[model samples]
Target: MREVDHIEQLVGKLLLLVTPLEDRRLHTDLHNFTHQLSCDRISYSAAALFHIDRSLLTSCIAAIAISIYLVILVEFGLPSLTTSVNNAYGVPNLSEISSYFVCIVMNMYFFVIYLFDIDSTLQGPQKTHTLLSLSLWTGLMVLRLVILAYSSEMVVQEASRTQRLVTKLQMLPVPASSGCQEELLLFEEQLARSPLHYSAAGFFALDLSLLKSFVAAVTTYLVILVQFQIPDTNKE
Candidate 1:
C-alpha cells in the first residue's frame, strides 16, 4: 500500500539523518562509533514507534468524535423520513454505526502496522527482548482486530433482527404494544449479555491499558533506527 511505502521511506530518511560518521576510521574509532550508532538508532527507532502508535490513538479519537456527531444528529435534528423508518426498526443511532466503522478501520490499521513492525524486526539486528516484546504486541493487536470484527458483525446482526421485529409489529391490525415492549426489553438484555459485547469492551480496555507499553516499544525502535556508526572499544 501507498501508506506503508510512505512510512517506510519516512523511517529510512529519519535513520539516515540521524546516522553519524560514514568515513572509514581507525579500528578504535570504528568500534566506538559503531557502539554509539547502535545506541542512537535504538532511541530513534523507539521515537518513531511512538509516533506510529500515536497515530493509532488519533484514529481511535477521530472515530469517537464521529460517533458523537452522529448521536447529536439523531437526537436533535429535523427527523428525516429515512431516519423515522430506521428508528421504527430499532436501528441504533448514528453513534453506534460510526463506532462500528471506526473499530473496523482501526483494526485494519493495527494489522498493517503489526506486520510492518515484524518485518522490520526480522530485517534488522534486534535484541531478544525487543523481538519478544514486538511479537507479543503483534499478537495482542491481532486479537483486538478479531474481536472488533466479531463485535461489529454481531451489532449489525442484532440491528437487522430488531428492524424485522419492528416491521412485523407495524403490520399488525391491532398493535401489540405490551408484547412489543416486553420483546424489546428482552432484546436489550440479550444484547447486554452477548459475548461479543463483552469481548469488545475487554479489547477496548486492553488497548487503553497498553498506552504505556506502546510508548516504551516505540522508544526502543527509534533508538535502533538512528544510530549507525560502529564504535571502537580500545580507544575508550
Candidate 2:
C-alpha cells in the first residue's frame, strides 16, 4: 500500500538520525510494518463486503459513522431491518450468540477507553457529549457491524455442514459396481474445488472469519482516532 511505504520511509529516517544502520537492518527492521501493509490491502479489498450492488464502501462506512456521530449520540438505536433472535424451543443460532458476546467485548472497550478522561477535555458547548452518549453511539455501531456479519455467516456455516455430510457419505464403504459411486465422487470433488462460501463478487468469504477481521479493523481504527482526538496533557 502507498501509506505503508510512506510509513516505512518515515521510520527509516527516524532510525537513521539516531545512529548509523545498515541497509539489511532497515530491510529487516519493520516486519510488523510489512504485515500491516498486507492487512491494509486485504481490508481494502473486503471493504465493500456488506453489499453486492454497485455502491462505494466508503459511503457505506460514512453512513454508519454519521449514524453514530449525528443520530445515536443524540438519540439511541437507529431504525434498520434487524431480526429478533428467535427464542424458540431451546434453540437458535450460535452465530447470534457470538455476536452478542462480541458486542459485550465492544461495550467494555468503550468504557476502558473513556477511563483516559475523554469527558474532561470537553470544548465547552460540546459538553453535552457525555460518556454515556459516546458509549451508546459507539456500542450501537459495534452492534450494527457484528450482528450483520454473523447473520450473513450463517449461510456459509450451513454450506460447510452440508459439505461435511457429503464427504462422510462419499467415504462410506459402497459397492464398486454401483453407478452412484461416480456421482458421489463427482459431487464431492465439485464441492471441494469450488467450495460453497458466499462472497461479494468473489472477493472474500462471508463467514465468521469476516466478522473477526471486520471487528479487528474497526477496533484498531477506533483506538487510533481516540488517541488523536485526546490531547497529550489530558492523557497524562
Worst 10 residues of 1 by lDDT: 226-235
Question: Which ranges of candidate 1 are over 4 A from the true structure?
Answer: 1-128, 170-236
Residue range 1-236, candidate 1, lDDT tens digits:
34544555555555555545543344445456555554554321233433334555675565466445444433443235324434443333234423534443344343344445532323434544554665566566545544544554566566567556745644544223224344444444443443222222223322233344444554554444323211221233
lDDT values for all models: 0.43, 0.53
Clashing pairs in 2: none
RMSD to native, candidate 2: 28.8
For candidate 2, write residues 166-200 as lDDT tens digits: 67866765434444455555555655655444443
How well does candidate 1 match the true structure, expressed as C-alpha RMSD? 34.3
After superposition, the stretches of candidate 2 with alpha carbons farther than 4 Å from their true spots are: 1-116, 119-130, 171-179, 201-204, 232-236
Error of 1 at 87 (Å): 18
